[model samples]
Target: MWNEILHRSWLRLEQNYHFNDSQNVLNVLKQAYAESQRAYHTLQHISECLFHFEQVQDLLGDARAVELALWFHDAVYNPKASDNEECSATLFQDLLKDDLSTALLAKISQWIIATKQHLPSSDQDLNLLLDIDLAILGATSKRFIEYQQQIQCEYHWVDSEIYQHKHKQVLTHFFLQQPLYQTTFFQDHFELQAKQNLTLALAGNLK
Candidate 1:
C-alpha cells in the first residue's frame, strides 16, 4: 500500500530522490500503527481514509499531496497527547525531506496539523483531506457506533465520568461546526447523516 502510494507521489513530484529506504520507513510506520495501546488510529484507519481519498481524487488540487498527507496524518497518534500532529508532521518531513520541496513539505505538514481540529479551510486540497479524515463521522450507523466504541477503548485509562464529559465536549465541537462537511461532495453525501450521528451521540444515544 505504501509502496504504490509513495511511488505515485514520488513520480509526480519528479524529484531527483531515492527511497530505496522505502521498506525501512514502511516497517517503522507499520510498527507505529501496530502498537498495542491503539484501538483506533491504526492501519485500518489509514486504509479507510485511503478509501475516501479514492472517492474524491478528481476534486483535489493535488491528489498526490493529499494522499501523502493522508498516509502520514495519524501516523504518530497518541490518544493521551496533544502533540501527535506535530510529531507526525515532523516524522513525515524528516523521512522525506530529501525528496520533497520546502513548499510541499509545508503543505503536507499543514494538512496534518489541520486535522487536529478538522476545521473548515479555504485550500481545496486541505478541504478534501479534512473531509476524507472525517468521513468516519458520516459513516453508516453501525460503523459510527463502532467508531465511538473504538475511541472509548483508546481512552480506557481515563475515568468514566471524565472521559464521558470530555468526549461529549469533543462531539459537541464537531456538532457545532456550522457545516461539518467542507466539500460539496462530502456535504452532499455526509452532511445529513453526520448531523444525525452527532446529534444522537450528544443526546447519549450511543451507549
Candidate 2:
C-alpha cells in the first residue's frame, strides 16, 4: 500500500520532471516512516492522511503539492526533536529542487510548516492539509484510544505523570480553537466527534 501511494505521487510529479532516483527516494522515505521508534508518526499515519486528502481533493487548489507534502510531513520525525517539520521541509526542497518549480516548493514548504501548529491558513490547500493531518482526533473511539497509546509509546522516555500533564495542555489548546478543522468537509464530519474525543481524553477517561 505504501509503495502504491508513493508510485501514485511520483506519477503526478513525473509529468513535470523525470526523476531517475525516484525509487531510491521512495526507499529512503519508507525507511524513515518505518523507523523503530515511530509509533503514531509512522507509515500508517501517512496513509491515513492521504486517505483523508482524497475526500477533499476537489477542494484543493494544488492537489499535487498537498499530496507531496503529506508524504514528507513526518518524514523527519523525532520524538526528542522540535525541528522535524523544518528538517522535513528542507529535505523535500533538497530532493526535489531540480524537479519542482520555485512556487510549488514554496507551497509545499508552507503546507508542511502549517502542520506544526495545525492552525487555519488563508490558503485553502494548507487548510485542507492541516485538517487531514489532524483527522485522527475524530477517529472512532477505539482508534482514538489506540492513537493516544501510540503517542504515549513514542514519548516513552517521559514519566507517565509528566506526559499526561503535557498532553492535557496540548489537547486543551485544541479545545480553545473555535473550530478544530477549518475545511467544511472536516468540520462537518469531524468537528463534533473531535471535541467529544478531546473532552473524554482530557478528562482521563481514555488514557
Candidate 3:
C-alpha cells in the first residue's frame, strides 16, 4: 500500500514538477524539512496533506498544481519573519524557471500565500491546499497535544508573553470563525475536535 502510494506520488510529481535535476530536488526537500520547527507541519506535514489530498483528489480541478504548491509552500519558513510565504513563493519561481510555466508558477505562489490566511479563494484547488495545510487544527486530543509541542519548539527563541499572545490570537481567530475547516473533507474529519482542542488550550493558558 505504502509503495503504491509512494509510486503514485512520484508519478504525480514527475508529471507536475518536471525538474530535471534530481539531486537539487532532494536537497530542496531536505532543506525545507530541516528548517521547519515542526516536523509534523513541515515535510511530514506536506506528506500527510498529500495523503489526504490523494484521497479527495477528484474534488480539485488542478490537483497537480496544488501538490506542487504543497511541496514549496513551507520551503522558506522563518519563525521570526512574517514574509516566509513570499520568500517561499519567490524561491519556487526562481527554481522552477524554464521548467514550469509562468502562469502555473503564479498559481502555485498564490496557493502558498493563501495558507497564511485560511481563506482560500473560491478556486477548489487552492482551497484544498490550504485545508490540507491546516489539517492539524482538527486533530485528535493526543495528536493535537503533540502538534502544540511541535509548534512550541518552532518558536523557542520567542519570549513567553509574545508567543502566548500570538498563539492565543491564532487559536482565538479560528475559534471565532463560523467554520474552522473551510473545506468539506476537513469539516467532516476535524472541525469539531479542533474547536474543542483550541478552546481547551486557550483555557489552560488562563489558569
TM-score of each: 0.90, 0.93, 0.89
Q: Which stretches of candidate 2 lie over 4 Å from their true place?
A: 1-10, 13-17
Better of 2 and 3 by lDDT: 2
Please write out the lDDT profile of model 3 over residues 1-207, one tens digit for every residue. 544554567577886666787458657766777764654547667667777778778898987888778778888887878998898899888877768888887888888888877784778777778778877777777777888888878889999899989988988988898787778888888788888888998898322
Among residues 3 or more apart in sequence or in different chains, the pairs in candidate 1 whose N, CA or C atoms overlap within 3 Å are none
Residue-level lDDT tens digits of model 1 in 105-152: 998999999999787777888999999889999998888999999999
Over 1-207, each residue of candidate 2 has an lDDT whose tens digit, in order, gives: 855765666677666456668777777888999999899999889988887877888888888778889989999999999999999999888888877889988879877877898867788888889889999999998889999999999999999899989999999998778888898999999999999999998887875
lDDT of each: 0.84, 0.86, 0.77
Alpha-carbon error at 128 in model 1, in Å? 0.7
Instruction: Give the per-residue Cα lDDT of candidate 1 at 200.
Output: 92
Clashes of each: 0, 0, 0
Task: Give residue 41's error in model 1 in angstroms.
Answer: 0.5
Report the poorest 10 consecutive residues by lDDT, candidate 3: 1-10
Give the backbone clash total of model 3.
0
Q: Model 3 segments beyond 4 Å from truth? A: 1-8, 36-40, 205-207
Candidate 3 lands at a TM-score of: 0.89
lDDT of 1 at 198: 92
